[model samples]
Target: MDILQYEFIRNALIAAILVSVTCGIIGTYVVIKRIVFIGGGISHAAFGGIGLGYLLGINPIIATIPFSILAALGIGTIGKKSEFGEDTAIGIVWAVGMALGVIFIALSPGYAPDLFSYLFGSILAVTSFDLIIMLILNVIIILTVILFHKEFLAISFDEEFSEVVGVPTKTMYLLLLCLVALSVVVLIRAVGVILVIALLTIPAAISRRFTHNIKNLMLLSIFIAIVLTITGLYLSYIFDLPSGATIVLILGIGFLLSSLFEYSIST
Candidate 1:
């Protein structure tokens, strides 16, 4: 309780909730559409934006937004239009993004003191500005989901049928990936680039066991994410462990328990 008195702790809690909501919403779509690989690609590619931010002396999170969106668009376009396989596109984008980050960091002329935080996450380091960014992105994500719920649902379940029925499946898919990009940027502040995909997928995966309805899934996922993240935050505070990794571990444990429960029910 006393730990809540610290501004960073308070900010971390807020960031956790915001991140949970964003990831829960977008992650549901990612899982349903089977685009986890593309999400991973966008997240790793965002590293280039982080490096560029360091080189330019700006906010890395902000830089990651456009950079991640481009990666998302590129992956979506190349996978659909080019003869290359989707896996190939993801691999190329992933490697190029990581390579660019290394190059940018090397050219920045100063040792990156906080690079590890961006790589693995440091929830305690979240600032007021980061909270605001998370809040705004949350608002955008929620609104987008609300506005296009039916279209997104249609495309996620059946792109060919959706298109035959006159839904703009391609546009909606690209937009979905872009939303995924934004979610990656928002999550980067809490879980970093490397572990971002796990955080994005795990809660939603757990929630799927309880509900097939999209709205309920998102709500349950958000609730589950909030619980796991805050629990992880408390444990980290008590033990002085890394918050991001701790949260991910907690989520992994939650998944294990859920799987066991599912198996028991099946048997």
Candidate 2:
């Protein structure tokens, strides 16, 4: 295999780095609280955003902002106000969002090729414009997470007590949903909406088997994601494999291996 010095390989690596920041930063809470389904729902909801943008002939990522927020809000509201675990609420939101996206696509005038790209991801085509949006969103997400670190920590570890201590647990949760929305948008292009959730969850899940501190886990998740992403990109270049799938598969394998290693240690 030629040493991966190519321009496309460089672009894929850069894009994956951007993805690590967004997904790894926010995914900590999702994995801790076991809200993995929310990741899937919000990503799928992004498709509805894409369809809406297609019908309006606007930038899909820009159009996706509001829809993604609404989807997040919907997930939180349904999970909280209604009688259901987050998983069921997320499932409902997932189905509803995809339903709307398909309807909007049917209503659209012509074929917009970007939809499939959003669905399955195309790392080779991540643009400079996408990078700027990614950086801006990265700033917003990281700052918010850091500023509210204590409060989020309290909520993530113990919601009942945080509410008792007046942490406004519900509000914190809503904000978390919003953060997931932003992260999903940032990641969709690199890993695609379908596989983005796996990338978000698998690293942290694997990392947690070895660490408990949320801060350490977040750092470890970022490290694991970057490694898998770089490896996947290199493999894609050498073997001409699909980038997103390869990356996600590496993440899954990492999780399995980590779990086994931890189990062996315990035994």
Candidate 3:
């Protein structure tokens, strides 16, 4: 109760809700499409944007947006058109992004005081500006999903069938990856680049155990993510743990518990 009085805690709570919405909606597609690896790759690739921001003296988060989108498009195109496997493409981009970030940061004139925050996340440090950015991104994600729900669903379930039906499978795939990029940006503040995929995938993965319906899966995932995020925030507050890592840990535990529960029912 007393914690609510603190501005930082309130901000963290708001950010958590926004993050949960983005993750729940976009994550369903990622899981059903089995593009979790692409999500991870995009998240890491955003690091290059972060480094570019430092080098150019701009907002790292802003920089991450464009950089991640380009990376997502590149990975999608290369994986689809090239001889290299998808995993191989992801690996190349992932390493290159991290290396670029490291080099850019090193070249920057001064030590990056907030570098750790971006890597590990500092939800407790979220300000009003950050909250506003997150809110806008969440709204955009929701509306986009609502507008293209059918196309996304068709493409996710069966790309070949979707193409047969004139669904523009390739375009939809790129659009879905773009959404993943947006979700990654939204999550960067809450869980950082390194752990964003866990938050993105865990909730959807856990929810899938209970429901095969996409709408239900998303709703359940939103509920689970909100619960775990708030619980993790509170736990981090009480124990002085890293907020992002704590949230991921709580989510991991939820995944294990959900898996066990499903197994028990099956047996």
Candidate 4:
């Protein structure tokens, strides 16, 4: 309660809520489409963007957006057109992106004092500007989901049927990957590139265990994510733990508990 008086805390809270919304919407699609690996690849690839921003002396998050989008598109194209397995494509891109980021940072002149922060996250470091960017991205994601809900639903359930019915499956898939790229950028501030995929997928994965309906899944995932994030923030403050890791730990525990509950019910 006393922490709320601080500006940084308030910004972190707002960021958490915004992130929850973005993740809830985008994560639902990622989970239903079984593209969790793609999300992971995009997140790691975002590191390349961060490193590029550092080398160019610009904002890392801004650099991450375009870099991640390109990585997402590349991954999608390679997976679809090449004879290689999708996982293999993702693995290659994942390694190359991380490697590129390292090379870029190494070539940069000065010491990257904040590099670790981007890798592990520092929610307390979020600024008003970061919050504003996150808010706008959240709105964009929400509106996109609302506008393309039917198309997304059709493609997620049956891409062949969706293409047969003239839903432009390829275009929709690419658009969804773009949405994921945006979501990765949004999450980088809160959880860092390394842990973004966990934050993106865990809540939605937990929610799916309880409901099959998309709307219900999104709503539940948002609720769970908000609770876990806030709780993790509080715990990190009290116990002096890493905020991002704390949040992920809480979500993982929730998943285990949910799994146990389901097991009991089935038994």
Candidate 5:
């Protein structure tokens, strides 16, 4: 409770909740649709946007929004339309994005301070501005889900069938990837690009064990993410560990425990 007295701590808490909403919602789609690789591609590709932000003296997260969306669209387009496989498209975007980030950082004048935080994360250092950005993105994600609930659900569960039924499957898939891109941007400041996939997928995967229902899965995943994030945040503060890595470790442990428990019940 004493930590609540600090502004940074409060911001971290709010950001965690906001992020949990998006991760829970979007993460469900990622797990169900089996597009975790695409999510990873988008998250890592966001690093290029971060570098562009640094070079241009702009907010890195803001820059990452458009950059990540483009990455999502590109990967989706290539994998869907080109002769290349999805994995191949992911590899291409992944490598190019990281390469561009390196070049942009090199071109930027002066040292890039707090670059480690963007790469690995620093929840304790989250600013009010970051919280605001997270809030806005949360709204966008929630609204998108609400507006396209049926379309997204169809695509997640049966893209080919959805297309057969005239559901505009490609458009929906691309839009869902864009949502994932937005979720990646939301997560970068808290868990960073390196570990965003864990937050995105782990909670949703765990929730899937408990429920096959999409709405229930999202609700449960959000709850799990919030608890894990808060627990990890405090533990990191008490022990002086990297917050992002700490949170991801907790998620991994949660998944392992959930699996064991499920196995025990089945046996």
Candidate 6:
């Protein structure tokens, strides 16, 4: 299939690049703070929007933004209050959200063909409109991360010390999560909810092995993510494989190679 022959394939390339930007920037924060599971929680919480979208007869993509944001807020806020471990709260919310989505989808009139698209990604179905939304969201996430880099750095490195310096750790934590929610919205269609946490963490995690500075890690992760995503897109196009699976496989291979390379150099 010639890439130029199909509009969907063309738009999918664009979406892949935009989502690379999203995961690249946000993934740095997630990896640096060791919030890998938190990232998973937010993506899982996105299912809440899926169910609500079905019950309300609305566009799932549109419904997902607010629903994910609310879930992120709840997770961040309640995680602070609950006596149990943070993951405990995140897990409870995560399981409940998935259950709600499952029940609602079962209750809806017809089977939603597009459900799998969001669940496991549909690179070929991406439209130019989706690309535009993705690009705009990427810009927003990037700019916000840059502007608040100091505060986020303070929070991630040492929350108690940051509080001593009056950094407003609580608000910063909430802000970081909202950014994660937005990242999930951008990524839901490109990489699927199940595997996006890999896209969000692996490249950054590998990159961190070599770089101590957050800035370098972010740059390296973005470079790795863009390369892996583009390579995956091309492979999926040529071999007729699932795009999301291809992307995850590519990232997994990249992670292994990066780890090996780092170890070899260190040894």
In candidate 1, what are the lDDT values of residues 198-267, reduced to their tens digit? 8789999999999988999999999999999999989989999998899999999999999999999999
Q: Residue 89 CA error for candidate 2 (Å)?
A: 2.3
| Residue-level error in angstroms, candidate 5, position 135 | 0.7
Compose the digit string of candidate 5's lDDT tens values, residues 1-267.
797999888888988888888899999999998999999999998999999999999999999999999999999999996689799889989878988888999999997998899998888888899888988988999999999999999988888899999999989989999999999999998899989999989999999999978999999999999998888888898898999999899989999999999999999
Q: All candidates: CA RMSD in angstroms?
A: 0.9, 1.8, 1.0, 1.1, 0.8, 1.6
* Candidate 3 segments exceeding 4 Å error: none
lDDT of each model, Cα atoms only? Answer: 0.92, 0.83, 0.92, 0.90, 0.92, 0.85
TM-score of each: 0.98, 0.93, 0.98, 0.97, 0.98, 0.95
Model 4 misplaced regions, further than 4 Å: none
lDDT by residue for model 3 over 1-267, one digit each (tens)? 998999999999999999999999999999999999999999999999999999999989889989899889988988886689789889988889889999999999898999998998889999898888889888888998998999999998888999998998899889999999999999999999999999889999999988989999999999999999999999999999999999999999999999899889999
* Model 2 agreement with the true structure over 42-141: per-residue lDDT tens digits: 8898789888888888888777778888999999998886568777888888888888888888898988877777888878777777778888988999
> Higher-TM-score candidate among 1 and 6?
1
**Model 1, 123: alpha-carbon shift in Å?**
0.8
Q: How well is each residue in 155-230 modelled by candidate 4, as lDDT tens digits?
A: 9999999999899888888889999999999998888999998888889999999998899999999999999988
Q: Considering only N, C-alpha and C atoms within 3 Å, which residue pairs clash in candidate 6?
A: none
Error of 4 at 139 (Å): 1.3
What would the TM-score be for candidate 2 when compared with the true structure?
Answer: 0.93
- Specify the poorest-scoring 10-residue window by lDDT in model 4: 80-89
